[model samples]
Target: MPGLLALVGGDEFKPGNEEQDRLMVAAAGAGPAYVVPTAAARQGPDQAVAHATEWFAGLGLALRELPVLRRSDAMKASLADEAGRGGFFYLSGGDPGLVAQVLRDSPVWRAMFGAWRAGAVLAGSSAGSMALCSHTLVRATWPNRFRRRAMEALGAVPHTAVLPHYDTFGHKWVESAREAAPDLTLLGIDERSAAVWHDGRWRAAGPGAITVAKGAKMTRFESGAEVKGLRQPARMLPGR
Candidate 1:
């Protein structure tokens, strides 16, 4: 049994994200929740974990912090075993490249993946979301804030990429994202919002909307709505 999958825009552990987190809680059952603050290693992982624990506590989930801040931490068999026991696992925001580099082929990631494959909910916010896909847009190493380079990711969701914080800085990367992975499905999720995968379709959640960018047009889907494109090579919808 596969569990829920969510890619949230930036601003995790904030006021606006409660709605979506609540949804995760309902589907999560009684198993423990784990927050992987690996991405926030340089940005203060302890603080990130604290925030996650506090936020999820309000949601009735006493979240455990999987503080695997380095490659060494990721390789520890004990840490990997702990990662495999969670009913819900969250990857919080920070430097996406660091997250990928440390956890890409590590034991912790493998254990976490097994848990997810066995029906544990998996969600990532901001850079965490970006790194869950097949390819991630790398920005930390570059001097220019707006410029990004494509790099390998965990590939939990194949042929897909997310632009978190769309209402803020994410929209600026639209063209760059397209150039990086033209064949991939491009999703622009607004801050505080999320696109969750249940079954084979994606559903929009939270206070904001989700945008699926295609060619010269962008379509928006409000919360509770399923985001889908018209079937190709078929009867067109008016001029579309």
Candidate 2:
């Protein structure tokens, strides 16, 4: 079976999605799903753990924090185990840049790629979703008068960049993505919306839509669209 990928622009571990959660569980051969929250800048270790704890409780599922993610070695080891188990891996929303930095070239990130290739489900929202891209547009530089640097991203989906939080405050700067990676596909996920791919089709699930921008062509998909395995590369930049 094809692995499940829940790519949300941002905002997860909030409420609802019981049916979707059940569907994801079923997709993973009815095995227990792993609720891994990588996005969470405000909360500390304890708060982050507790937040996911409650979110999974509602679905009658257990949540485990890959604390190793905080450490390079431990994170890699944990991700290796996560891949071996063939269980679901859910990346919760927070800071996309931090998530990539924590997992870049680490064992956990390697395991994540392995799991995806092995047909294991990989789900994430907000920052988590952003990290899924080949080039993640992280909000490292706040772009204020005092801060004048662009955020660095961990490229997971090479040649493709992400435009996360398109419906949130981040929408204003999303256009700048073209300048970053002119030749790449832009996936703009909306809040409370999910971009799920399974069985060779991309299905939109939630109250919002997923916008794709390539050059000047911007299209929106509703709850149903067969976009699986489709290679939508980004538009090439000038002089590239």
- Give the alpha-carbon lDDT of every model: 0.81, 0.60
lDDT of 2 by residue, 154-190 (tens): 3434455556566775556555666656677777766
User: What's the count of clashing pairs in each model shown?
Assistant: 0, 16
Give the number of the best model, judged by TM-score.
1
- The clash number for model 1 is 0
Question: For each candidate, what TM-score against the reference?
Answer: 0.91, 0.79
